[model samples]
Target: SQRVMETMAEDGTLPRNAVRIFWSSPGYSHCCFTSQNNLDPKLAAEIESAFLSVTDEDPIGKAVLEGEACRSFVPGTDIGWEMIEKAAEAEGLI
Candidate 1:
């Protein structure tokens, strides 16, 4: 992990070029939220709004965002993961 790499480097424990990356995803891994099918639509919208409202500038929001490795939450879209989903289904992993 990046945190472990930084800590080891600071302590002089990590060797040069210890961490190497061959490839990285173009899109970031994201957290997704969903409600039960029977849940109220208005309540779901409120929950979504609350998540979208969190910003790094707010203390509590900052802590939550840091824990999640994200600076802030943004509105999610189905289109974002459509390709990954299709690939997973093709591999019979979905």
Candidate 2:
């Protein structure tokens, strides 16, 4: 990712010497799904499964995934979230 940024800067899409990657915390999702706590467990499982089932092989799945800039969905986790939270707080984004 940093290489891509540097290449862009070289190509003049971004100002040279202006690009800096202060922080990066991979494996942390930028968005999430939530439902009411009262939602039925079975229905919740179904919803989760449906999301995880999407892949680039199916035409509709490919379109949806590409539109959202996502490759595929995996089980959610809070891993690496603390670093992201700290970075966001430092930037006053949260």
Model 1 segments more than 4 A misplaced? 1-13, 80-94
TM-score of predicted structure 2: 0.59
| The candidate that achieves the highest TM-score relative to the unseen native structure | 1
In order, the Cα lDDT scores of the candidates are 0.79, 0.81
Model 2, span 12-91: residue lDDT tens: 89887676888866644646776767999999899999999999999999998887667997777656568877998999
Give the poorly placed runs of model 2, Cα more than 4 Å off. 1-12, 15-23, 78-94
Residue range with the least summed lDDT across 10 consecutive positions in model 2: 25-34
Candidate 1 lDDT tens digits, 1-94: 6656676888889975788656655656567775566899898789889999999899999999999888788876656677877998999976
The count of residue-pair clashes in candidate 2 stands at 0
